[model samples]
Every structure is written in C-alpha cells, then in structure tokens.
Target: MKWFEIGLVVLTFASGIIWLLDRLFFAKARRERAGLLDDGRDPVVVDYAKAFFPILAVVLVLRSFVAEPFRIPSSSMMPTLLVGDFILVNKFAYGLRLPINNRKVVGIGLPERGDVVVFRPPAYPDQDWIKRVVGLPGDHIAYRDNVLYVNGEASAYQTIGQYVGKGRGEEMTGATLLSENLGGDGRHEVLEIESPLFASHGAGEWTVPEGEYFVMGDNRDRSDDSRFWGTLPESQLRGKAFLVWMNFDGAAGGVDFGRIGTRL
Candidate 1:
C-alpha cells in the first residue's frame, strides 16, 4: 500500500507536469502547425497527460485528505466488519496529511474511544490495520478475562445472541454475539467464541504512552492489536473508518450487496 501511495503521487505529479509543460512551451507550436499534414493533434504523451491529469489530481486529493477506500482482508473484526468489505475511511478525520509520508500538515481531530480507525502498525509501517480505539494517550488500559477496561472502568456488554456471519465470515457462525458500550464511543456488536473456551491472550494492565493510542478488534480473542503490538503511534494514524462501500469474498461466495453502504 505504501508503494501504491508512492506510485499514485508520482503518476499524478508526472501527468500534471507534462500537461503544464505542454501548455507553456509546446501547445502554441502545435496550434501554429495545425494546418500542416499532421492531424493537428497534440503529441500522444501530451494528449494522455491532458486527459488524465485532472482525474488523477482529483483522486489524489480525495484519497489523501478527504477519504480513502480500504478492503478488509481478515476476520479479526468479525461480525462488525466482514472479510472482503470495502470500506471508506475519513482520511482527514484525524488531520490533513501529505499523501506518501503521511505527515500531518494541519491537525483536526483525535481518535476517540470506540471509533474504528485504520493505521500503520508499529511493526509494519508499510501496511495498514484497522481496529477500535480503546484507550487514549495517558489512559490506563487493561484486558482481563476477555473484558476490556479503560482507565479502570469496565465497558458494558449485553448478550446479543449467536453471530450468523456471511460469505467469508461464515466460519464465524455460532460465536456468541454481544452489544458492547464503550462508554464514550457508543454501542457496537462483538463476537466471542464460547465453545472454544475463551483464553485471554494479552491480559494485563498498560498505560497508554503520550502521543499513542490503544486499539483492539471487535473479535476480542482473535485480534492482533495494541494488546499484542503495544500502543499505536499517533504519527501512524491513517483515518477513521465510516462506511462499507462493497464486499466480495471469492471463497464459495462472491459479492454480498447487503454489506454495501453499511455505516461503521
């Protein structure tokens, strides 16, 4: 994905430069020679640049600052966000950032508890991972007996029956579903596998460091999140996820239109 971002920035800049250069230096010559044997067409490269520059620039601006699309690749988020769900992340929800390096140019908002966010993991900066923000900077975070506690206050969980997932998420069926209220972030559903016996993987108390955040997945027992990798750095924050644009799981199922447009 880092490569993709780099390539996009390069392509957009190259196309824009080509188009601008032609306008300043080559366009007048081409127009002056319009009556020649040539079809009066701009050079092939210039023609392409003129046609694609606007489109590329628009996409770059939107993806870099307004919103960006990301597809869920694993079942870690479970019933809340299915595998193969194409989601729209609000890129500027946290701040305005440069495209490739993701350096913030203007700060906007901070990740709130319970908001689903996409970020580059500390262990793998090139990759993006999405999870729920559970603890903010300087907050006391703990996970014990499959329960999440923030600043010594336990989140409320109400039984929501068994999870019946679809497409690639079908394997997660029969897991216990519950509605969790993260005090400040509102309510969301989570899945816990009862039959397998819940084993707390990273059960311990941790104080979120300054300029970092603690995140976790809705599928409590299966997520590789802050519990395993430590707090997420503020600089690696990408955006807050807000919508599911599409879903396509090639394993036994294809597109699931029902998931499209789902608000996270």
Candidate 2:
C-alpha cells in the first residue's frame, strides 16, 4: 500500500494537541475541584507524542513544500551518493506539487539534461525512484557499449580511477569510476560495474514522448531505472535531491560524520 507520510504527520499533530488540552485543562480543573492532589500525569505515549508533534509537523510542511529529506538506500547513485547518506531534496525546484497525489499546480521550471531528479516509478507509481535526467520530452536516447547517446550526440566520459565503497557498500568497492560530462554543463563521477550480458548494457534507441523524461542511475550496472520500466511522466516528478544532512547506517552506531552536509 502507498502510505502518505504527510497525512501521518497531520494525524500525529492533531492527536498530540488533543492529549495536551485534556491533561492541561479538563483533567487539571476536575482534580482541583475534587480536592484531589493527583491530576493524573499524561500517559508516556501522550507525552512523547505532544513533545514531538510540533517538531514533526514543521518538518512535514517544510519537506512537502520547500525541501524534503531522503536516504540513499542502495548504491544506484554510488560515487555520487552513498548507501548510508541522508540527503535533502528541493521540493519546490520543479514546481509546487501536493505530496502523495503529485499533481503539479504550478510550473516553476523544466527538468534539465544533467539534473538529478526524484520521481514516482512509471510502472509502479507508488514507488519513489531517483535518477539523472538524460532525455527530456522529444529527445532521443540510446545506450550502446555502455555509452550514452542523446539526440544523436554522445555524452563525454573520462576514466576517473576506481570506486572503493566502504561500510555498508563495501561489497561494491573497487568498481570503475568515470567522470561523465552531460552536454558540457558539468562533470560528475559515476560508478560502472563491469558486467557482461547486463540487460542495460545496450538498450534500443528510445524517443521520450511529450510530457515524459528518460532517466538512468549513476551506477550504470546495478540500477533498474527507466531503461527497464519506461520513461517517467512529468506528473510523477517529486523533487531534486541536493544535500546530505545526516547518515546513520545502523550497523555503525550513532552517526557517519563524513557524509554530513555533503551536497548532492
């Protein structure tokens, strides 16, 4: 089932307020009138809920409209994002869209060629996916011999050493790292695993239809992105991931100080 995080936040806020009002006003008044010294302390659950409700509500509003926090779960964006990295996404960069429904009420800007975007899966609209925008509306995209071609022009790539994933991503260490240039905008590092017979190695040419975009993960070999399911509709876009606020891998206790404040 598709769970709505924003809706959950609203419920938490409402419940907390009700609990606080009951304890501070009604309960206190009744106890005082009855001459009973005990005013019945609020339940532990109620206390915690009240304490965290406001904070979470503010976060939910900021996240749904201004910016949102997300964690990289896999190495699909390796070399750019680590598995334990907690990143921030710009919610208003694309447009002001309501969470859950994802209907863009305002059109602020269009997705650029080299932008890192988060969107709902076209095949599975309930699932959130992130990738780099390769082909915009009406752009032809193709991948041959692990090289990307956009609109009949090949993207530039230079070998940049090897990726050495550590901690949670240790298994993917020593993969090839390449400095990729997307249409001369900027250069970014990408991880490429040497896997022969990979399904995404050589994809047939695909033209992004109107109101659609073609995306691909930085980790070319490991991602199941647009190449597998299909292009993402414009309405499916969520936001643009931009920063890493925190990182906690669970296996590694408290926090990963290295990934904090890292920009995406």
Candidate 3:
C-alpha cells in the first residue's frame, strides 16, 4: 500500500478510537466528575479527532472511490495531455475499487478503445502510467511502419504537419503530427518521429489476453508502453483521466492559464 493511503488509514483509525473512547469511557467519567474542577469534557485528543475525522473521511472517500488528481510527469501522452498537466481521473469510471489494494468491489464499466487510462504496468508495479487504450481483450493489434492495425482494419489518420512542441514539449520538436480517428470512439492527436524501424523499435502484433488491454502513448515513437512492456492487466488499472485542471510548465514560463480546465 502507498504511504499516503497508510497515513489515511492511520488517521481514520486514530479518530475512530478517540471517538469511541470518549463516548464509552471519557464521557461517563466526565459526567461523574462534573463537580470536580477537571471534568475532561474538552480533551485535546477528542477535540482534534472531532475537528479532523469527518474531513479526513470525506477526502479518503473522494480520492479512493470518486475522483483522484494526478500530475503528468512525462511526454508519453503529449498533444492530448502535457507533461505538467494536472488531471482528474474518475476512480469509479472503470469500476469501484478499494484504495491502495485496488481490489474492485463494484462493477460499473470497462475501458473502451481510444480511452485514456492510467494503470500500473506489469513490469513495474510501483509506477503509475497513463496511455490510450488501443486494443481490448481478444483483439489483434499490430504496429508496423508507423501504422496501427486493429483486427485487420488499418487505423485512418490525417497528417497535420510537423509537430512544433511547446514549453517542455519543445524537446519533441521535429516529430510529425497526425489527427487519428479511432472509429466509433473519436479522434485524437498523435505524434510520431521519422526514423527507420530498427531492433527495439517497439513494433509488433499481439492478440490481447482476456481481462487485459493494449495501451500506447500518443507520442508513438517516443513512448515505452505495451509495445515494449506487454499488455496491461485489468487489475492494475487505476482510473480514466477526464479533465486537465492545471498546467505548470516551468520550461515555457511558470504557469499556463490557457490549458486550465481543458477536458479530455
């Protein structure tokens, strides 16, 4: 479990113990000693628990089951999501899962193609990764010559122009931009560098296993994704990113107000 989650659990447990002790033992003692100078009605621990318990519970519920905020750390999801974008992920969008452990307790829906999802890669369980879903379970996916083929149907994309990266994204300059249309899902922007396919280029065809998903980054050539690691397990999925609440691009300026409140 994460340290933050452990801290939350500690807070919740401590608060509950304080409340129960006050109700069962301290309150009766205070009532019996009402005539004494120290009645123990306003103990410091009880006051602190009363002040923070509800707030902590609400935050835990919201972050664990409702919505959680995450900051993009890399250029893997560029164009659609930037390096400094602070995004909100819907925790219950895929299903309701317990925090830290990530064991699902409620079934809501499953991820669809073209959906931007956050999951822990099987190779690296401690790290969190965000990518676009390209293939679902039992689907045939291929990436050859910078083209994606899903179930024998080649993906259609329109070349936009040479990608002009901005701010920290400037490092990705010279890449090509393409407006990719994932039929029935919607359209999104992707970036690809012009380079000859070599060994370790992360190109291949795979039939996704059951309860697994194939994910790739918007920055095709630069992303180390399922193309490199392998299909993501359904259990490792964290949530679906839906909105960009803030962007702090230190490389560009300090803060970019234009990207605030952008929906995914």
Best by TM-score: 3
TM-scores, all candidates, are 0.94, 0.80, 0.95
Which window of 10 residues has the lowest lDDT sum in candidate 1?
Answer: 193-202
- Clashing residue pair totals per candidate (backbone < 3 A): 0, 0, 0
What is the Å distance of residue 212 in model 2 from its true position? 1.0
lDDT of 2 by residue, 1-264 (tens): 137675665676687787778777776665565646555566566677778788777766797799877767887887788778877889989999876677888889888887888888867777777889989999989888788889898889999787877777777787888999877668788877777766456377999999999999998888888888888888888999888899877755658898888876
lDDT of each: 0.89, 0.80, 0.89
Which residue pairs overlap in candidate 1's backbone? none
Backbone clash tally for model 1? 0
Q: Give the TM-score of candidate 3.
A: 0.95
Instruction: Tell me how many residue pairs clash in candidate 2.
Output: 0
